[model samples]
Target chain A: MTAVLEVEDLTVRFYTEEGVVTAVDGLSYRIEAGETFGVVGESGAGKSVAALSVLGLIDSPGRIEGGEVRFEGEDLLSMDESELRSVRGDEVGTVFQDARAALNPVYTVGEQIAETIEHHLGYPPSAARDRAIRLLDRVGIADAETRYSDYPHEFSGGMCQRAAIAMALSCDPELIVADEPTTALDVTVEARILDLLAELADEFDVAVQLVTHDLGVIAGTCDRAMVMYAGEAVETAPIEELYYDPKHPYTAGLMSAIPRVGDDDDRLPTIPGTMPDPIDPPPGCRFHPRCPFAEEACTRTDPALVDPETGEAATLDDDRAAACLEYTEGLSGGLDYSVEVAGGTGEHVEKTIDERDEGGPDE
Target chain B: MSLRRFVVRRALSVVPVLFGVSVITFGLFHLTPGDPVSQLVALNPDVSAAEEARLRERWGLSGPVWRQYLAWLSNVLVGDFGRELRTGRAVSGILWRRLPETIVLGVFGWAFAIAIAIPAGIYAAVNKGRLGDVAARVLALSGVSIPNFWLGLLLILVLSLYLGLFPVLPPSRLPLYHPETLRYLLLPGVTIGTAAAASVTRVMRTSMAEELNEEYVTAARARGLPERTVVFKHVLRNSLVSVVTLAATLTAGIVAGSVVVESVFNWPGLGSEFVRAIDRREVNVVMAITLVTAVAVVLANLLADVLYAVLDPRIRYD
Candidate 1:
């Protein structure tokens, strides 16, 4: 399938007073047509910065130093200001996390959404407003016609997020970059919003690049997942393969960290250490300082992502990969794969793989 | 209660404060070394002792101090400013005639400042850190730092001397009511207004800059709204409360600072009348001018507070 959105070797940096801070370090991923690609990372992992770079919104002192963000086969980085406007809402819409702050307080929700429609699609005021109401209705807002005139402050958090989603879909853009859309919501609201996003993506035939830190969310909504560690992707694979047979140590640690819903365990599994500082990040492998199975070479040389030798039958379409030294040698060799790697072919007669490296904790 | 009620409450509270202010002013004027009666008698050496005593009685200076205070206060409340001892002219009449000139200068000065400052401030903010912003900042800094008196003198020298525009002194040849009289007023008004305009523009620019950085601005950009529409229609209105409040307070300050400007230009305004009243030992006129000035300040501040509440919903009267 053709890639709907492709980010190639994206690097974003900020020239601060102290020094140049690397926010995103050579990140690369893609979302296929009508697929949900989840980029999971912590706050400073440059997820938002990467999204802003796609929209050409990076301001002074912070910039896309090196990257190509291809949205629907068009290079966004090379577009001029006027050209970028055509792409921003008409081609690639965005739904920010903080819905209350994202929407203008002075304008009614319908007015705000209608503005996007008028600018991008050239809809007349009446038609644009009707479209706004229809979009709001589609997003589960009741009394869509009447409540369309209400300001952002009058809406609840969940309702505001829904309105923001409606605004994002106003122009029916091909790609939607939802930056931490459900992070600020309660558990119930988060589930509803996630389900809403999934349903909308299917109904609209639009690709979604969902930026989130929740691994479970990635498992539920994303076709593929990118695990980010200290501004670099540690693993990228189909969701089931990533959860079942994660190869990178960081991905393994992340899986172990998820608490199973029904497990009656007193203590939950956790990964020790914090994300490395972007400025003066660990020289070789950025994750070496925190990796439990770090070798001397792991600290001296960055491990490049390569296909693990899982034989012809073991690989998934020859794309799923991990950035770890253990994966370089034979996968079934006597390596310290303390974490279990679950759900692969059992007929490949080879050396033993660690049984403890099983599937990710179930939700 | 509503904002209108709050303003009334605040305005009413000022009366007691003004009373305290007036008592202090009256005591200071009386406690000074020179006695007005002795000064009057010394001016006319041929006056006999009985004749001088009769003159003092006529002016009510012969009354006990407490009775004199009560009489002066009662007369002031009734709008009967006592006659000046030297010229036998009622101080109220003098103020009524001259107050218009001061009001004229102040109104024109304030209007000019606000007209020029608002757009300049918006430009400076939109083009921040650019050449226009730099130039505007430098102009404002100069306006603030340069003394108004010196600036008035320089304008008089440049515009009056080289161009032969306005008169060196006020247009005393023509009655102040004549049309040509405005030319004389313009130079002084501009001198007083420049500093105020500069300060107002700087404040507006700072506020606009802050509003532009808000998350809503980012969201607006994300929605594909044009730059001009985003700035003028959205950011400017959101940021207006602070700028309007600054301009209002600055205009009030200019009213007070006009004392020096009026003196330098020799325009027959309240400040000139005030200084002359002081020199002539006219206590009633002096006290009345002080009361008027205090009232002007309090009212101006009240107007600013009221406007703030109107412009920003976040502002509420407690």
Candidate 2:
């Protein structure tokens, strides 16, 4: 498989009145052709900012300081405004976090999609409208031809997201940056939306950069995933590997924190401490304040992403890599954690990771 | 179909509002210390008490407040505004003659306000806090603060006296629809529209600025839409909803401003007639003008309500 987008050493900054905030620091990731790449993290992890920077969408007071966004071998960052405009809806489409808010209130859903089609594909309004209706119907909006003239307010949250998804796919772009596409949706609706996204990504042969805070969302949809914490990726691995055997302590904490359906415990195990302020982050490691496996060295040594096998610096091609002192400078106490996959076969009741064996599920 | 229903419902709702306004005007007239008959008697010293009594009976001014209001309302409904005390001329006829002039002036002012305010507001919003925005804001501030009477005089002084652009007297013989009258309309139009333009510009700026930040704008931009399309097509539509709301209120300003603006322009409009009627205490003429102005303001607000539903799809008139 070939890489469709290669975002390297991306750094985004916001020049706020208080101070300059380094929102995304040296973030690096890539999405291969037709592969769903997940960028999972807690809130304020700079997922959306980094995604926006790919399209050169950062406005005043916020700037994309440094980045090489190579989309199909072309450096998008070097492109001028007009050049970027040609690439935006033509080759890359974006679905905003808030689907309803992302849709223009005054315009009909079909018109909004058709307009992008008209602009990017050079189709006339009639052709664009037909294409938009078909796309809307394909995205699962019932009576899409009739809903063609319906305004955004007339659509429910789920329907709006479906329309937004339809819009993203309208131009037949090579890539889609869905920034928390299901965040504002109902719990039941989120699953169906994710399924639709994955199905359409495959159908349209488009790569997706799915940004979400939900690990379960990534686990079910993404082929490969990168776990980000405090604006930095701590681990990058295949979805199953990341879930079954998390490399970073933060990822393990996240995996363990997923509450099980049948678990008797009222309190869900959580990763302690909040995301550190971007303006003035901790000295050594950003996540050390919250890491349960933090050693004395973790407080002093800032680790770069390296291979666990050879402890050498990992390249973009490396499938499994982690940025921890254990993988780089080496932790004195050594890192150890066991993942407990409860139940048998099909759907599991509980699958959580914690320190030590702690025994398997009694059931 | 629903839009038509909404329009009918909204239009029907205006009846009660206009009736209430007419009632208030009549009640105020009735509650005053001297009745119109007595005032008329006082003005003409040669009038006998029997003649005054006959005038009172004829005018139905001897009834209670509600009855008086109803009597006045009944006459007004059928376009009978009584007759001027001094001239003994039909107040309705005088009103119809002056009404068109005021309507033209008001329309010109309204048009001028929209033309200047919409563009100036869009410019300021698109280039917020920049030099153009700052300049537009300053101009808008001055437009709102400066009184129409002062602005009218200044416009006449400069455009009529210094620049030689227009004459002080409005074109009298030329039909108002004639092109020559338009040139004469400009001075007072600008004078009346200045405050409204300023008021609307501020609203447009704030409304556009807010809409510019909405996610739809960024979404539009993300779709490879030219920056122009994002700002003009998407942002402008959302911003106009607020502008329409403010437009309704600015009508009051323009109407009130016309009163002063008319006198300064020496335009034969209802506003100038209103001033004369007040000065001479022509109770019939004054009451007719006041009721007309009140109805106009009520209608403007009603128009705004209808426009609000049209501009924003979420607004349903249930």
The lDDT values for all models are 0.80, 0.87
Total backbone collisions for each predicted model:
5, 0
lDDT of 1 by residue, A1-363 (tens): 888878888898899988899888887887888999888876687888887888888887898888788887888888888888888878787888898888877677889899999988999999999999999999999999998988787799999999999988899888898999999999999999999999999999999989998988998999998888877877888888787777777887888788865558889877788888778898777887877666666767676666765422222234576777666533222234454443246333332245435432221
CA lDDT of A175 in candidate 2? 98
Stretches of candidate 2 off by over 4 Å are A343-363, B43-47, B63-67, B162-164, B170-173
Residue A60, model 2: lDDT of 82
TM-score of chain A taken by itself, candidate 2: 0.94
lDDT string for model 2 (B47-145, tens) is 998888788877666666677777877888999998887678999999989999999999998898889999999999999989999999999999888
Lowest summed lDDT over 10 consecutive residues: which window, candidate 1 chain B?
B309-318
lDDT of 2 by residue, A236-355 (tens): 999988988787888888988999778899899998889998999887888888876676777787888888778998888888988988777666555566677764664545543333
* lDDT, candidate 2, at A30: 81
